[model samples]
Target: MGTLFRRKSRMVVVDFLPLPPVESKRLNKAISETGFCSRREADRFIEAGQVRVNGAVAGLGVKVTPDDKIEVNGEMISKEVPKIYLAFHKPVGITCTTDTSKKDNIIDYINFPERIFPIGRLDKPSEGLIFMTNDGDIVNKILRAGNNHEKEYIVNVNRKITQAFIRQMSNGVPILDTVTKKCRVERINDFTFRIILTQGLNRQIRRMCKHLGYEVTRLKRMRIMNISLGKLKPGQYRHFSPKELQEINQLLANSIKTEEASEN
Candidate 1:
């Protein structure tokens, strides 16, 4: 397990590349793997002529070695440390932010021995399975539910559940500036229901409830894709198992995070 992390500082070193190396890192892949940005973003930057290698404009197909000086928008892109992926069951009232100044920020609450940040938000009033990772690039890949990843939630409403509400929620609810995509909503009890959403809108579920004239008394995320919030109490976390990580990698294998999907 010690091999997974380096005892030295978080700063990583880039080794010198051998001359005429058999293989070199592709510009987009190198930038994405460095956790600087998504590969989609890297490609866009290259297209916009914002990327440079050895002080020359780098195209999309350009390759880089350790000897190459890669820059974006005039700032050099450097090597990155290894990434960490964590699953956390956050308690209500903990803010999902990296800003340590926030009194109840999730970062300060978890206080992992190393630097890490929550992948997506669970909101201050809600709780449950939220991913914490040091890889910024993977954030878009996971959160872009347009790729068909599912996020399940259990909600308790202020009023008794109704078939009409379930049908409407399952069909779709018009909120914000656009209608929400169709999702699975089923009743669990008089005032409780389970919902699986494929789109992450800003305060989506809450807004949908308000529009239906129902108030959410409690909300808890049960799962994100294949990862479950099982046996995890509030303010608790665990490293993803090998099986879990393997399945996730398979799921994200062909998924590329684009700007359009990230807006969701």
Candidate 2:
């Protein structure tokens, strides 16, 4: 009996020994790990008193362990949520913004079951293929202008075919306080042309056409990097195929992902 009692005592003492510290990360990071939102959005929730850790309001920069419960706006955030990636065919007039207050916002239009944001934006007046994902890390890597990812567009201008116009566009055009980079521009028809650009400036194709004395009648993006619209009609969306996802991951393997510093 004494031997058994001693063994129990030893077990109790072992249990009392200090445990290795539980890994903890910033509150915003913990929330973002669930794929619920980006770190910036998480910080906003913290500042707005919409985030709670273990039933207490969370503060900015607070560290949380994996075992801690995290809730946003009274909804418990689960880290097991699946990451979503989509290629959407944006229709003209749909704004590429997350603000629900704004009419015709892309988020409202898609009504995705899981919260997601566009990787980059397409102009409201122009439309075509755009990427949407819940993985915030991938968004930065894909959107970074320096990454040199290709975005292809088919543009219709109000003019007759001119060899000089194609030559000038392919060479480069001055716009947005800087000369645009040389890109591949090919004439498709009398007034239609295809352009693949590595840099995304504000309304780049439109501005380039206007600079050359042409007005864009229609602008539609056809592809982004390796993904093409591929029969997805306007306002339609499709999940990224496994092969596409694999290729994209391979492409971004060496790409850099960055986050803006938030004051909150």
Candidate 3:
């Protein structure tokens, strides 16, 4: 009886020693940050028996520590490096997509070291400057629906443009279920015009001209925000200079500050 009691006491004392705390976040956060899915969707994947930890099926509420192995859909997930930003003068007929299946996708046209995506879209049929970046955060800042970043385009119409049409365009023509925002329009020649817009509504220029009973013969974007196409010819690209980058960063900072102030 004494020996049994001593052994039991020893066991109890050993059990009282501290154990490591379980990590709070697990597979869900990893999967979500990898852009595989949202947190809620990750949880569903766990519950559905689609996730694995160390090659074993994982269930919801599974605790994942730093050393634990994790996989989703039979693929391993690893941390990615910081994203890169780039600028390219997209020529006509090149689709602004990464998909290789498309005959003339942007990826095939520009041979860059990193995988980048356009901040916003430039239609395949149109030609001009386009911003490309892998940094998703900047994409939101530049392309947010409410952002008023000026985009300038040189447009050539099929027919002679009259002063009345220019007045109507500047005065705000109705299109896309809303009155077009006030914009800057200048007649450069008999059929050529320079337009600066604060809002991007799909093929806005094309739609606007169509509404005014004019056909756009050629359209080319010359500027976005503070960056200009400059002397860049079609199908050319270059890195932003330090000053250019600083300017863009400043613009984004100011825009964010303005938005926050308005909410308050």
| Candidate that scores best on TM-score | 2
My TM-score estimates for the predictions, one after another, are 0.74, 0.83, 0.71
Indicate the residue-level lDDT of 171 in model 1: 88
TM-score of 1: 0.74
For residues 192-250, write the lDDT of model 3, one tens digit per residue. 99999877777888888999999988889999899999888888988887888999998
CA lDDT of 223 in candidate 3?
90
User: Judged by TM-score relative to the true structure, which candidate is superior, 1 or 3?
Assistant: 1
Off by over 4 Å in 1: 1-18, 21-80, 259-264
Query: Could you tell me how far off, in angstroms, the CA of residue 38 lies in candidate 3 after the best superposition?
Result: 14
In candidate 2, residue 147 scores what lDDT? 74
Worst 10 residues of 3 by lDDT: 255-264
Model 2: residues >4 Å from true position, as ranges?
1-23, 47-50, 55-62, 259-264
Clashing pairs in 1: none
Report the C-alpha lDDT of model 2 over 122-205, residue by residue, as the tens digit.
888888999988876687677666777788889999998599999999999998799988999999999899999877777778
